[model samples]
Target: MRDRIDEEITFRKLEVLLAFMETGNLSKAAEALNVSTVSVHRALHSLEQGVRCALFRHEGRNLKSTEAAQMLADVAQEVLTTMSDGIRATREAAGYSSDRLKIGSLYSLTIRAVPGIVIDIKVRRPTLQVELALGSNAELLDKLKRGAIDAALMALPDADPEIESIPLFEDDIFFAAPAGSPYANQEAVDLCDCRDETFVSLGEGFVTYRGFLEAFRVAGFTPNVTMRVGDIFSLMNLVSGGVGYTLLPGRVRGVFGDQVQFIPLKPQFLMRQTIGVSFLRARERDPNLLALMAVCRLRTRSVI
Candidate 1:
């Protein structure tokens, strides 16, 4: 009996019938299913014969559902949902959980914020394995949209109504120089003093670099950026080696310690990027995502 029912009502036939019902035209259904119109007509015919009822009737250019197709719509939707649930549960049971959380961040947080958050999450949930992927903000957003990542730690991304964001922390940018540099001894160095100095900077497209440009404009000079690197640690290395002074996030000082000195600018320019959690809003209620969110919030509170 079960085999008979399965033979009569299979997923492929249901797919065609569902498409026909939605579009109300044989050609439209064929287009949606990527099959020829004749194929759609044949599938619908086969479906009607299997169920022993006429499923549709002609109405001008449309194929309107006869009582049976209307009746099956609700059932088809339920079956599709059930199939989705079954697949998800099967993958979970098989331990095929993806280790594909591709988190992207600015260089400053990659070293300071990302490591601690990941460690704390691991300690709290050892079974949930994670793989960290890093890139600049624009690249990361593209990856997230392409389904290459589950979530990201991004500075304010461009306007996207589909994404959900939760601000983690705000950090100020600061001027830092080697400890003995003339500007380092001052309580607050005017940006003008650093005009002639070679500077180490994060490559453009970074939040730090953007803030640096704003501060430079305020100071009335296009400061020379002699060295541009993608990562903050490398940039710090240049700073500590006295390669040049740079504007960096305050969090950077936590890692470099006394190797470099952080100085306030005379005008005390405060530009911050809000590090936050971002993911597709449509994916909001996922259990694993919720667990990660809780971990992020807890870690953020501890930091505060």
Candidate 2:
């Protein structure tokens, strides 16, 4: 017989504690749990009163775990994992398996690389239906954390303990100019040449934008930004129309379809961004994930 749940140990309390542990901030934890922040606060308060001990110490919006709280969190994770596997097992025993796989990626990648990989996977696993979600890097990561997506193909995110990332491809950054652009025929051009050019760029808060800024710093010049827009296709379109030149990833040629010409910078400026597969560490062991990883590994190796 299974042991009874503790009178005070409600699933709600465990969920509150686990969410806090997963995300360092209360608001984000509430977001992950799909509950109001106030509800989470009340649940923790009630839990503390019932347990007769302080489980969390507040630091601004963050809840730092006490030793006891950490202990409970470890067990809570075990409980959650057990519950998840139990459900999966029950489904499998019923002769039911998920028919569709959810995949995600950034806009730039969805146009070419991700589709190619998806098509290849479909040919190999005809029983699987692939669903694609496209978004910015941050949005996709949030979806993965909340179990909204199985995995994504994207640039490496900021350091995240919960995310398990693997390298797939290394793309170099290049300078893209319109045909007959001033620096077009030049064997190589100085970074400063772009200093005065009206720069069309991706909006702030993109990994690519951050990398682009760093590349400029390395090239020893600050670009004159005349416009900022979202999506690489639009940026490429603007560049093609002679609005301004922008830094282009080596793979941009594959997506932009010969609409733009790539010029090698004099010093050959290249910022290597790995386009890899990423998923929550917690789901890393799912059988579907394992199969997907095998497909990605096989495809990525062939390309490299």
Candidate 3:
């Protein structure tokens, strides 16, 4: 037969018992816990039945606790305290980042989008430390899934049940070339005209690299890539230094406006990279994540 305590006892009942013990009256315990007085009475009654003992005695309209009740209350407090600490440690071990929020994002966003969000989030939570991890879109998403980062800001990917994505803004992919290059004079650059041009691109995992390939592919040719780099900043430097031409999102224009030219792509080759924040769906209710989400939503509202 199942033990009565094992079958009927619950942490919630213990909470009610502790509250009653602290407040010394069912009505007051209910007020403290924000529950009805009858609910408190029921929890205590159920707790006594579960332990199969007389934990309390009625004294007119009030209940008086026995020695056994005091013992159980002490154990319950210890158990709840230990469980709270254990849960925090476990979440940190699993990459939930309780003491600080570790956010991963594409290097391109660090120029503007990320810095603004970081400042606003810090303003909202003065004591909470925030760390930024910069990488390609794929790298950020990988870190998020592995629990290395609490959230990611990058090009939103296809739906995954485990991830909850919040779209913030869309950035256009522009044809990037050295400022003095012949292509810079154009109103809108067509990818087909650049087929004969040499290019430098971000390696396979980058979202911009994928856009680079698709734009040229639609032009009915593959780019003659001279070099492939890991990060967008390096790729931008190569273009500015006249290493070769490349495709980049408009977000980087601010940093390279003088050294490089960003021309809008012809309609057929144009693509918008949807930038957004993504996080584990399981952590949607987490207070830290809720704060970050609130900031992201604020940005979304502003841009719209």
Candidate 4:
């Protein structure tokens, strides 16, 4: 019996039942649903036949819902509501919503790069909804490849063949320390000078960590890392408290303000972080991605 009902019942019939329940008259129900009176009568008749139950009673020219009909109506309302929510969630997940734009970026860029691009995008597309996700370079790149994010602001060059990147600018890696530290006053600091200094470093998997390794290799020594922090701000805070020195991009100065100083690396030990926007090569023609790419180019052109 349950199988029979499942095979017979349909959303159109439930909608007709709901309309009939509200209007209590076949003609009025049909008018509300934009169907003919005969169509409404036939739909209600089919619904009762499908469930093998009496769902309505006639009083003169009007039809009234029975207890069984009211119960089914309640269940139908719930089903409709759940289906509506599910459809909306699916659309958001698929990135099919016209006004939505999902963006991924590194924590360090949020201090300045992300904000500038967001403001420019909002000005150009006032109704566009922006969603920002911050993560390490590897995580952001992964999200882009999987279509979880529309675009990413990260270091280049991503090895994924599907990822097409546009270079925004090259940011020089600098040695960061407390403002009163001895290295803060130097014109340029050699990485070897800090070889013995207990260092504060970003956790492995961060782009900065890779650059840190390269600088150490050039200096001919490994750092005696004292802490592995997850975010640049926290790493800077530790350095400010006289914890240890760290390596970071020049842009970090905006966040640390006067608390920290960034010194250039000596010519022989100089290393740069190439910052850029990345997206799936297939989404190159997507309007939202294009808009974001334009904003990034406009904002970084002057600074780079």
Candidate 5:
């Protein structure tokens, strides 16, 4: 009988049923689940069929829960709540609870923003342990989605529906050239003027690369091919060595000191990258995540 019931009813079906009971409207329940209304209807219908009972009554186009449905909904709520508590308790026992937050970030932020943010969080929660992981924006986002990290600091706009973000600050993109380069003397350089110059860049997956490509597109010319490197420092080194010019955020201006000169792009082609903290919406209520978010809000406001 236990096996039979498990085979018939699913956890998702129970969640769907509870959503319907709480919202009292199929469309609202669908919205809450990030699913279509038809999917909600189908799940509820399948649930009723599996239980071999009528859980809802149709009053015109609306669904009203039956007495049996109400009882089941109560039980489902209790089960889910208990399961959540159990998971939390287990994680705590394993030292993977709210006291420890895994944070992921883009490699570029490691030089400045990330260190400051981490320091702020530490000052607030002295007992808290933070694990910092640095990677490309895509890698950080992927880690965030997999729950490998509690939050990620990356560039916007991230279109993933499952992730929620807080815009911390905007960093302007600049044209980088060697100190001796003629373009370095200008207050602002037109990208079109550099159309024939060799360009060094952080290959495709990097957010800076996308911004670099878009700036060129807006400038009405494709940059001459030269080098594609993995990290920003190396790309900057190459630029400082007079290998080619590259586009980078102003935040990284301090990295190579005066070795490379950063010039603002022409107004029409000006670009700014929005840097922010992103996390799964499902973990929004986690205490550690909430604390980190508060710190981010405070620190970003002070700096930016």
Candidate 6:
């Protein structure tokens, strides 16, 4: 019984019929659906065979829709509409936000990456509103875990069973100094050699702070004490104003223009931040998140 029903009618055929009815011709329907004219003709023919009736009749050189075809087109439109609405409602019940996507991000990313990503997402979903929540990496992660936001853009955290990540890009930690500093002329800075130099840092909750601590741990000594700031932009400005040197991700290199010099770190003291989107493991199938993941992947490819 199931096989007989499946053979007699199919969703794909309904879509083709609706396209044909709306477009008024084989080639036009094919163009609307992004399929070949031959495929459209074949689908309509197969649809007529399945229904065991005449859907189109010859008139001069054109095929005009018969009464059965017109009737089927009306039913097809209703069925497809109900099915689409049902699917969307089902997804919304399962945690998909159909109207707005709330995104959390590190404040640093807003300077270079977030603007382009937001613009592209808008182009893809014209009616969907995007809200950006900026905070430290830890803060963003907490919001994401609590459902305060739909997804987060920040450094990848340690592997967890409840969280999923899509890595967009990797950024190297650079030693940033005021433009007139002695280190400005050097190609690279050694973290171990700078054990006595004063340095600025994002607060402990920031991802870059984790990198800062880890690099020093690898260097076998703690960095000299200076003031710490709550945001990356302030910390960068502190470095630019000659308050103290700081380690920063390469992504922010363009933020300060020529005021700050970004130098690479020697190999043993090197660290890189893998920045990406993070979301709930169970909600990976949410339509909004899936679209965001697709956008992230596509944008990453273009950047590469």
Candidate 2: worst-modelled 10 consecutive residues by lDDT? 91-100
Flag the better candidate by TM-score, 5 or 6: 6
What tens digits encode model 5's per-residue C-alpha lDDT throughout 64-145?
9999999888888898888888988887443346668889988888888888988988988889999999877877877877
Q: For model 4, where is the 10-residue window of minimal lDDT?
A: 1-10
Query: Which whole-number lDDT from 0 to 100 does residue 14 have in model 6?
Result: 93
- By lDDT, rank the candidates, best first: 3, 6, 5, 4, 2, 1
Per-candidate TM-scores read: 0.66, 0.65, 0.72, 0.70, 0.69, 0.69
Stretches > 4 Å off in candidate 5: 1-96
TM-score, prediction 6: 0.69
Residues 75-149 of candidate 2: C-alpha lDDT, one tens digit per residue: 888998898788877754432336667888888786567877887777777898888998777778888877778
Residues 1-304 of candidate 1: C-alpha lDDT, one tens digit per residue: 4646636667888888889888878888899999999988888888888888788788876667877788887788889889978887675443223433445565567766788877776776677777777767776787777767777886767669888888888877788898788876788878876778888888876767788899988888998888898877888899999998899877777677888999877765666767787877766776666767887898778663
Clashing pairs in 3: none
Question: Compared with the true structure, what per-residue lDDT tens digits does model 4 show for residues 15-99?
Answer: 9888888887889899999999999999888888888999989888777889999999999889888887888777655544468
- Greater TM-score among 3 and 6 belongs to 3
TM-score ranking, best first = 3, 4, 6, 5, 1, 2
Model 6, 129-212: lDDT tens digits are: 999999998898899888899999999988989899999998899998999898987788888788778988888889899989
lDDT of each candidate versus the true structure: 0.77, 0.78, 0.89, 0.85, 0.86, 0.88
> Candidate 4: what lDDT?
0.85
Looking at model 2, residue 222 earns an lDDT score of 83
For model 3, give the RMSD to the true fold.
6.2
Candidate 5 local Cα displacement, residue 153, angstroms: 0.6
The most accurate candidate by TM-score is 3
Measured with C-alpha atoms, the lDDT of residue 91 in candidate 4 is 64
Give candidate 6 regions above 4 Å deviation.
1-93
